[model samples]
Every structure is written in structure tokens, then in C-alpha cells.
Target chain A: MSTEIAIHIQDIHKEFLLSHSGSASLKTALLWWKRRQLEELKVLRGLTIEVKRGECVALVGRNGAGKSTLLSLLARVYKPTSGTITINGRIAPLLELGAGFHPDLTGQENALFNAMILGLSRKEATARIEPILAFAELEKYRDAPVRTYSSGMLARLGFSIAAHVDADILIVDEVLAVGDFAFERKCFAFIEEFKQKNGTILFVSHDREDVLQVSDRCIWLKDGQVEQEGDPLTVLDAYESGTA
Target chain B: MRSEFQELWRFRELLFAMVERELKIRYKNSVLGFVWSLLMPLATILVMWLVFKVFLRNDTPNFSAYVLAAYLPYQFIQLAVLDSAQSVLISLPVVKKVYFPREILPLASVISNFIHLLLSLPIFFIFLFVIYATYGFEVSPFTWRMLFLPVLLVITFMLTAGMAFIISALNVFYEDVKYAVSLLLYIFFFLTPVMYFSENVFYALKDKPYGMLLYNLYHANPMAMLVTAYKKTLVPMGKIDPGGGEGLIPMLPMNWPMFGVTVAITLAFFFGGYALFNRMKWRFVERP
Candidate 1:
């Protein structure tokens, strides 16, 4: 794989105004400035990173350490408030369990819609449905509504569709945290396969072994900034020891 | 902005799938299904016939047909805009999880409701046929100009979509948007030419200074113009009853210049709505 950069997130800062009550109505919004009930919650503060094409990087962090927020920004689910992110290829993100699944839609329908949204054409997504359902081991429930699926089933299907997308970069969060052992193994195998195909990956995890097994590099985020980064074993050791 | 359009074009297939999903979910497991969809307008026709023709003793000849021409379009406007107002809020979880053209959320709602509007059409035609046969009404009111139904619908679509974009995005920030929108529609129902004919408004403003301007202003409300245009195209502008019966309001001539202005403004609303949505989309995830 060429060493060209695939993802460039530079000097990114993201902040959310922690509203005690969400300003979901005009009446509240009109009084929002008057009440002064908002507190600034800065999730990612002046963070920067770059991922080369075909690299697999894992992020390990404590809860609220900004790892998920960083992954979301890369996925383009949330834009950085005070910085620019330049991505050079199509991105397929598996951010949560059944991220885009509609409860009323059949598994097959959700698969097609999810795959299409991830940059697959109708023909391409249709062709991949069998393999996707097969990978998720959901062939028996293909026509069943997604709402009927368990959380594990949802994760399996979400991963299967993201695996099939024709994307150059894949961003993942704790989506794999809920699936079974065999499903997790299958996901790791797919990540290895994706890496071999020159795909860039950025993933967030709480598992140390997952960081070591899949990531060539590991980044430890602390309070929205990169505290440490480099060889997975070294960073993992640092992260674990530092947390301990 | 150009990139946004290009991205939306690339996801056009997804848009249609979303529209299909919306339609499927509306009547998901109900046994009556499509019949349930037709029942609302049918009931509207019945109530109009009972109240206007029987109870009020109004002899405008084919009364339900007139009310329906206006009522049907208003339903389309209300259904599309109201559904769109909640579209983003309902899909917030998915919005925070994935990325597609955010505009698709509201666009799908508008389109599915447009299909609902299309599905509602046959009932109107069926009611018209029944009235013609039962009442021995004068020669059929439909003229060749009925071909312009699609053009009138297109204008109404632009107006609703524009309003949907603005409201759906605003709703994410202000929860009151949906309630306010329904309230606004209630007010507009009275303002537009839904219960009565456009000719009534024209005659009311006939001779006074700035009367033409006032008429133009009323038609500028796209809903008002759309319903009038629907009646003008569907029912002949000429008199339906030569007997000069009670409740017989004259039909107004099609105002070509005002129509041109309305079309331009409707296009502006559509684009303006889209622009506002795009501006607000990136911040949607912040509140959650």
C-alpha cells in the first residue's frame, strides 16, 4: 500500500454546551440566553492525528475520554467545531448497534439501505446482501423486522454491512463490544482483510487485547487530547500502567 | 453548496427507498391498509355533502367536488409539512450514527405524502362521477385545462418541501416547531380558498383601491394559489348553474401574472429551505 495519508484531522476542537434541558422548543430557545443554564463541555480539545492509507489504529481510553467523539468526527457524524478534517476516500462507519437500522424494516431492507448509505450502488448492495446476511448468520431471519433482533444480532448485522461496503476508510466505535466470540473473531478477520486491501481503519475500544491484536499503532486519548501514541504494545502498557 | 447537490444526486436511490419505507410504515400491519388511507378523504367528502348540501340547504350544485379540490391539497400540505417537522427528531439516533445527505430525512417525508396525495385523487374523481349521475347536474365541469393538474401539484410540492426543510431543521433546535406548525396550518386553512371559491375573494376586493394588490398578496400564499389553481384547472371557470341558485359563487379568471410570481416565490422557498437545513445540519449532533 502507498504511504499517502488517507485521514487528516488537524488541530480539531469540539465543544458542546451542556444544556440542563435540551433546547428542543422555541419557547425554551427564546429563554435559553436569559436563563444562563448552559455549561461548556469540551470533548475534544485541540487534538490532531493522521492515518496513512492501509493502516489500522486503535484508540484506548477511559469513558468520556473523547475516543468515541474522535471516532464520530472521523466518521463525519459530527463536525469539529473549530478545526478542519480532510479525508481522501469514502468512509464506512459502524458507530453503534444497528446505527441506521429501522425497527419496522426487515433485516434485508435495512441491509440494503445501510450498505447503500455507506457508498454502495443499488446493484452492488443487492449483490452483497447474501454474503452480509450469511456473515451475520441471520439468513433464517432475513425477512424479520430488525426490531425483533437482539442487541447482539443487531451488532452482527451492522458489522456485516460495514464489512461489505466499498469504502477506503472504516471508522468504528464500541459496536463490537456486544457481539459473541465467533462474531468478534469474524470481525477481527475482516479488519485484517480490510488492511490487506489498503483500507485505513480507526477504531475505539476498551479492550487491551483488541488494541494489541488488530492495531499496528495505538493512541491513548485523555480528556480529548492524545496522551500517548505509537507501537500498540508500548502504548497499551503505558495506558494500562497509567490508569492503574 | 454545489457539492451538497452532487452528494444528494448520488444518494437518489436511497431517497426513494426512504420514501418507500415511510409509506410501508404508515400502514405497516393494519388489515385495512390502503383502504384506511382512502377512508379519510372519503369521510371528508361525506361530511361536506351532509353539512353543505343537506343540512345547510346550500344549492351550489356539485358542492363536495369544490370543497375536495381545496381540501385534498390542504391535506397534502399539512401531511407533508407535519411529517417533515418530526422526521429529523425521530431519526436523531440514526443521524448521530451515520452520514447521508441530511436533506433526505425531510425529502422522503414530503415525497411519501405526495404519493399519499396521489393515492387520494381517485376518491375525488369517483365522488365527482357519483354527483354527476345522481344530481343530473349541468354539463360536466372538467375542461381540457385539467391537463395542468401536474403543474399545479408541482408548485404545491415546492412550497411544502421548502416549508418542510425549514421546520424540520428548526424542530431539532426548538421542540415547539411541530405544535406551532399545526397551529399555523389551522390558521392557513381559513385563510386559503378551501371551504369557498377563489371568486369570492376576488369579488370581495373588486372595486377598492389596492384591491388587486390585496388579491395578489392572498394568492402569494402558495397554498391559496395552489387550491385556486386546482379548482380552476379541474372545474371549468365558467358558470356551473344558469339558475342563479343560492350558494352559487362565480369562478375567477386565472391570473397569469400572479401565477408567474407565485411560481418564482415557491421555487425561492424550496431553495431557501434547503439552504437553511444545510446550514443547521452539522450542529444537530451537538444537542444530543
Candidate 2:
């Protein structure tokens, strides 16, 4: 496997059926031929991009410009209707903080659960549990059910688990715009350290400062296509002007 | 489809983790944590015993033993189906955000209840041990054929997992699936022999013109076949002694040909369910 290119998405397209939306009833489900009434909505159209190893690429776009869909595609939440997505490493998708947390589970348990979901073995997750709790600053509340934790506390724990996964590519989707200022800074600091480790990153965010600070390069998406690509400041400025 | 299996295999540890979470959360807030799982079956036995022996003057003899074989597997299937119908809906937030094989949610619920099934087997054995100890060993419930217990259990699991995959996938598409599953299970409870032997059904319909055919066709119901198999294997001779000496109601021989057909049907259902789930999985988060 070539380790140089981290993610190579070529001419990918995605379509979703707008009708026959759900199998809410036996009648609808049994009427198989009637499902052809579905209206197809193409969310992503012929989008292609490649990220080199150890690059931090930020995606900036207006609402409904297909940024979220593209990140989700990279995260494998949804597959492409056609085209190829070849990736060369472990992927830790931080699409939303507390992505798989059970409110009734304690901090320690949820951390172990999240680590395993992010592709760690029980033994490995156990080994890192102590560090994850310490980093999240939830060591004192480790045994307490996470339902009792504040929203900020939940995001902190969520971010802490993703940080420990040692993933080759990280798909972060606007999760930093959460928690208190101090914790947000800590998360940013971790992202900087992650970048220093030659980790590839594809991130989506509406925060201008966060984008400029974290991304090495930037791509602007509009109407399911790449509108512009260049240095972080230039693309971010262009995206800002176009949206304005 | 093959990659989905491999992905699920790679995430097998997560399956364990999810099952653990389910069992833990189920009883976590209660004073009696794990014992509550035991109490459900115990209470059920007590209720059914009261109904059969005390109230209706219906004497089936060791009715608790009779119901035990059917109840355990029925509870496994029922619990799995009910929870699996809500599995995706409850995890909708996570599904929208993160990516996993997504089958793990339903599978974890099924397996946790399966664990409950395993745990409750001791109670059945203990109940039988006491019964046998009091009433001489001449009427032992278990036979050497009990060795087929594991095979029977796996078949039950396949039937359960197959149903779990389908309902859970359907639930993601339509929230109505949860309600329909509950309604169906309530009706299905009567159809499965949770209260009486499957033989009772066969005997009831024996006088009808199409009786023999219907009786033979009855085994085709996966639940009917499984529960009967369990009862026959675990409690070979079901003799009713309502304080008066009575003869064992000898269990009919295992219907081998019917059993073969039932297994085939269960396999087809299992594969069909897996195929349906995979086909609908990608569209789970799609909204027009």
C-alpha cells in the first residue's frame, strides 16, 4: 500500500431517494413497485479530491453546500453512488462529540466503548483508559454515570477518546465549537500535536479562526462541487466573500 | 456484502462492549441488579403455576416445568425482537454522526437476552432437580438426548438474529415497525407454546378433517419447532402429578422431516434478513 497519499476520492457521486422515504407500514413495504415513485436527490456530484500524508485540509462552505455530506462520505457513514474512495490507514471519525456514548454508562465504560468503536481491542482500550480519563479531566467522575455530567463534560470525554485512537486520518466535523473556552483550547492544542505527528486531517468548520489556525490548506465546496482550493487564508477569504 | 461481514468481524469486540452496556444499563439503577433478570422468569412461572393449578382447575402436572422449556426461548426471541425494533431508532443520533457496521446495535440486544437465556437455564435445572428429588428419579425429565441442547440453542439464535436484522433495519426506515412488532409478538405468544405443549395443539386439531396436515404444518413455525425441541430434549417425559399419582404424558418422537424443513426455512429467513438489512443500511440516514 502506498503510504504517501492518505485519501484519494475520485469522481464520487451520491444520490438519495426523497420518497418512499420509510417503510413505515406493511402496505408501503409490500408495494415494492410503487417505491419507484421516489424522487432522487443528488447530494454529491462528481466530487474528487486527494489529500497527501501529513496534510491538514479544511472544508468551508455555506449551509447545504455539501460539506457535511462529503465529510460523512469520507467517514463511511454513507457510501458513494458511484466512484472510488481509497484510504490508506486507520480512520477516526469525530463527526460529533459523544457519537456513541450511552448516558447511563460511566466515563470509564463509555471511553472503553468509544475506543473499541474507533477500532481498539479491549486490552488496548483498557490500557489507555487511565490516560483518556485524565486528559478529559473526568478522573474524579470516572465511576459516576455520564448522564449526570454536563454537556461540556460529555464533549470533553468524547474528544478525549478520539484523541487517543492514533488514527492515520482524522475526519473532524465542527466538534471544536463546543465545550468551555479552556477545554476548547486544550482540544486545539491536541490537534496541533496530532498534526506534528504527521497525521492527515480533513475537517469541516464554520469557525474562521479555528479554520485558519488548524488547517494547512483549505477547499471550498459549493452546490456539491469544489469551488476553490488554495492556502487556508485565501480559500477561507474567498468562501467568506462568496457567501456574503 | 462480504466486506460488511468482515467489518462486523473486525468490530466483534465492540459487539461484546455493546452487549455489556445493555445488560449493565438495564439493571444499573435497580437495587437488585442482575437478579432482576432472574426474577422475570421466576414471576412468570409463579403466575402460570397459579393459573394452571390453583384457578382454572386445569391440571397439566408440573406445568412450571412444561412452560420453562418454551418460556426461555420465547423470551429470548421476544426480547430480541422488541428491543431490535427500537435499536436503530434509539441510536439514530449516533448513526447520523459516526460510522460502524450498525448491525451491532441489534445484535447486542439479541445476545444480551441470549445471555439471560443461558443464565436462566440453571433455574430450570434446579427446579427439575427439586421435583425429581421429591418425586422419585423414575420420572426423570432429562434424557441422554439433552446433549443436543447446544445445537437447539444455536438454531434458536439464528432464528432470533435473522428476525433481529430485519426488524431493526425496517425500523430505521419506518418508526411504525416498533409498534407492529409488539402487536405481532402479543399475538405470536399464543401461537408459540409458552403455556402448554405443542402436542396440545396437535391433539386439539386432530379431529378436524385437515387436522393431520395442519398439525404437521404447525412445526414449520420456527418458534413452535424450537420450543417443542427444547421441551422434548430437556424434559423428555412430562408427567402430571397433581398430588395424585399420574402417568407421564409421553412426548411424541421428534418429527425429523418437519425438523429438517423448519431448519431450512430458518436458514432462508436468516439469509433473507441479512440481505434486506444490507440493502437498506446505506439508505438509513438518507432523507429526501
Candidate 3:
């Protein structure tokens, strides 16, 4: 309940039921009714974490360590099985760049749609369209369908829209890994500026140097639970040595 | 439920944007563009007219208008339900990436199809005017009853939207929901009094033991009642002077009390569909 706590997650446990037959057709379901099997994949098990206002926290873990699951839960994209999550600020999630953009829409149109989906009004999204296009360096291709844009261009537009939302909390999940070096540098600069403006960030990345450069604190998830947390270097060093 | 509405209200802009996206993408590459909406229904009306009036030698006055009125709305509901059934599955990426009212996706489909239905209305009116002028069909002038068309349209929208919500959410869990819906629509087309008049069903089965039961069952469908109500309110504009000309076939003999019952049933579907959708939506994220 503390006012300073930007995100409060308590004893979070996430279990996904993996259907053996991926087809959701009624015929398949009826045929498999007697032999239907669901294997529960426990992604996050009783992991507790609290992120404070203006804190930049990085989650580092190997694949299947539930790093992305935790971020998704925090973003309210999925509900925890038996725990409560309280987020105190508007969140701008860059989980997967251009995940919501339609291929048929122009770059500017997709940016506006993505911004509105992230909680901006039509007028507000329209007003920010110019700045977003400018930041993404997509002015020349603003009218072109996004299907024609390169992957780097899509990432740029996605990052630009996410960055301009002016949200209290920003969640980035390895989105920077796709951008080119120059755009990555521009993104890092924006992240630093965002931090200076008192924004809370929950970043997930596998890059060691990038984690060290941006985060004030680090949480290492291991086998669905937090193995270590606190000082960035200490935890990262321990995590690296353990993985190595 | 109240909080859900409040949340939907907060994301109203997103809803509008989604609907706009659907409409634009639907007609994007087609040369005819928006005109296709009018042409598709007109083509259906033409085929139905040839089959009923020419081939069968049917004698229903203003048969073209009657078929167009019923068929246009039927096509709208069918398309809306069928397309919206896949709305959630199609937007899986967006659903997993962002947090908004998931209902907006299916709702947007409903609204976009509703727009198409609205666009086709003018063509329907023009068809009616042409039949009256050229064929000397007994067409009533516009009347005060036409004001009730909007109410009937709203009821139809609510009914289709509700079905879309239920089918689309269920579709995420069972992909066959779309196929099953399409099959059911086919059966429903024959069951409802769309292609034929309700009076035909009554007269054909009048001597049978369950004749009344069969007739009542036909009118029980909300869509049937809606079509009947639409014909009553919109098709028959005013009473034709009996001394000079023949009047249209008594507004297709609608059952008023059953119409009220159908309205209540549609409202119930809307509430039930909304409840089921809200309950099942959290499981959507769990699905692949």
C-alpha cells in the first residue's frame, strides 16, 4: 500500500496448462475427450518482488526461467494463479515491438493505432504522430504500408510510440536487441532521459553489459523463483558465473 | 459489470480505431471498394427474385422488396457473427502484448458489419422505388411507423453483437466454433421466415396436428421476429386506399406479442453473452 511502490507483486505463481493437441477444433476435442491430457507448466512459482518509483530494475535469467512471464504478469497481460499484483501507474509496455501493428496500415497509421491501444486519445495520438515519426526516422516512409518496412524500421516505430506515451512505468522485454547499433544508442539515450524524468522501468534482457549500464537493481530468476536480487554487479556476476 | 463498462468507456477511442481499421482493411485492395457493399446485396436480391418470381412462379406482391428487406439484415448478422467469431484468435498478438478491453475486438467487427448494413439500406430503398414505378407494385408511402425502424435495427444489432461476443470468445478455446456457427446459420436461414412468409408456414401446416406448434417455433427465433418487425414497420409505409388499389399483404401478419417476447429474448442473450464473455476472457491469455 506504500505510495512509493510502483509495482507490488506478492507470492506470484503462474501455471500454464499445455494442451497436447494444439488444435482447438470441436472434432479433435470430442475425440480426445477420454484421453485428453493437460500438463501443467509452472512458469513462476511464489516469486515476490517490489519495484519502487523511479527505479530501473532488470530481470536476467536463462530461457524458461520465467523472466518474460513475470514481466507479462506485471504488465497485467496475464493473471497470477494465487497472488495479487498491484500496479500504481500507467504502464507503457514494449513487450514485442510492432506486435499490434497491422501489415496493411501505413507506418503513421499503425503508430497512431498502437499509441491509442496504449491509452492515448485520438487527438493526442494524432498530435504525437509527427514527433513519433521524427523519432523513428520514418518520415519518408510514413505513408507506406508497414508490410514494406524493414524489421529495423518496425522496431524503431514501435519503440518511438512506446517511448512517447509518457507513462509512469515502462516495461521493455529485450526489444532493443533487434534495433541497429545507432538506433540502440538512441534508445539508450531515451532510457536515460526517461530515468532522469523519474520514470520507473522494468527491463528484461540477456545482454550483461546492457543490464549493467541501465539498471540500478537486478533480479535473477532461477527455476521459476527469484534466486538473487539487489546490487546490479553482484547479482549479475553471480548469475553469470553460475550459468557459465 | 459496472466497472467493465467503465473500462470499456475509457478505451472507447481504441474501439473506434479498431473498427476503423477493420472497415479500411476489408475494402483496401478491391477496385469497387465501398460500392461492393451495395452490389453484393443487390446481387443476392436479384438471384432470389429470379428463383422465387421467375422459376417458382410465386405470387407474393412486392416479392423483391420483401426478400431484400429480410435478406440484407440476415446477411449482415451472418457475416458479423462469422467474422467476429475469429476476431479474438486473429488478434492474438495484440491480446498478449497490450491490456485493453478484449471485447473491443469482437465489438469492432459487429460495428463494422453494421456499417456495411447501413450502407446497403439506400440501395434497398432505391430497389423498392423502382419496383413501384416500373411494375406497379402496391407500395405504401412512408409513414410514421418507419420511425420504429431504428428500434428494430438496434435490437438486431444487439442480438448479433451478443452472438458475436459469445462465439468469438468460445472460438479461442474451440476453433470449430466458427464452422459450427456457419452451419447453424444455414439451418437458421430455412427455419426463419426469411425466404418465405410466415403465412406460408401456417397455411402449409394448418391441417397437421403440430401445425400451431411449428408456427410458434418459427416465430420464436429473435431474428425471425426482427425480420417480421422490420417488414411491418419499414416495408409497409402507409395504408393503401382500398377503393383504388390493392394494399400490401397486411404487413406479413406479424405476431405483436411474440415480437415483444422476442425483444425480451434478445435482451437476455445480450446480457448472457456479455456475462459469458467476461467470465471466459481471462482464459484467453492461457490459450496458445
Q: List model 3 lDDT by residue over B1-288, tens digit each.
A: 889889999888899999999988887778889887887778877898898778876666677777788888898999999989999999989888788999999999999999999988887788878877785655553557778878888999999989998999999988878888999999998887677766666666767999888778878899888876776665763221111123333434557888888989899888889989999898898874
DockQ of each two-chain model? 0.64, 0.56, 0.70
What would the per-residue lDDT of candidate 2 be over residues B196-262, giving only the tens digit for each residue?
7776776668789999998887777888888888887887566443322333455568888888888
User: Predicted candidate 2: interface RMSD?
Assistant: 2.6
Q: Give the Å shift of residue A101 in candidate 3.
A: 1.0
Full candidate order by DockQ, most accurate first: 3, 1, 2
Candidate 1 chain A weakest ten by summed lDDT: A21-30
DockQ computed for model 2 against the true two-chain complex using alpha carbons: 0.56
* Model 3 spans > 4 angstroms off: A31-36, B135-139, B237-252
Rate residue B164 of model 1 by lDDT.
96
RMSD values for the candidates in order, in angstroms, are 2.6, 2.9, 3.1
Q: Candidate 1 — which pairs collide?
A: A24-B174, A24-B175, A25-B174, A25-B175
Clashes (backbone N, CA, C under 3 Å), per candidate, total 4, 2, 0
lDDT tens readout by residue for model 3, A1-244: 8889999989999999887766656656677562456678999999889999999999999999999888888777897898989899899898476998899889988999999989899999999999999999999999999999999999999999999887999999998775788888999999999999889999999898899999999999999999999999999999999999
Local distance difference test scores for all models:
0.84, 0.84, 0.85
True contacts kept of 2: 0.63
lDDT for each residue of candidate 2 in A89-196, tens digit (9 for 90 to 100): 989887365867888888899899888888889999999999999988999999998889998888888888888988999988889876888888998888888889
Q: Is candidate 2 or candidate 3 better by TM-score?
A: 3
Best by DockQ: 3
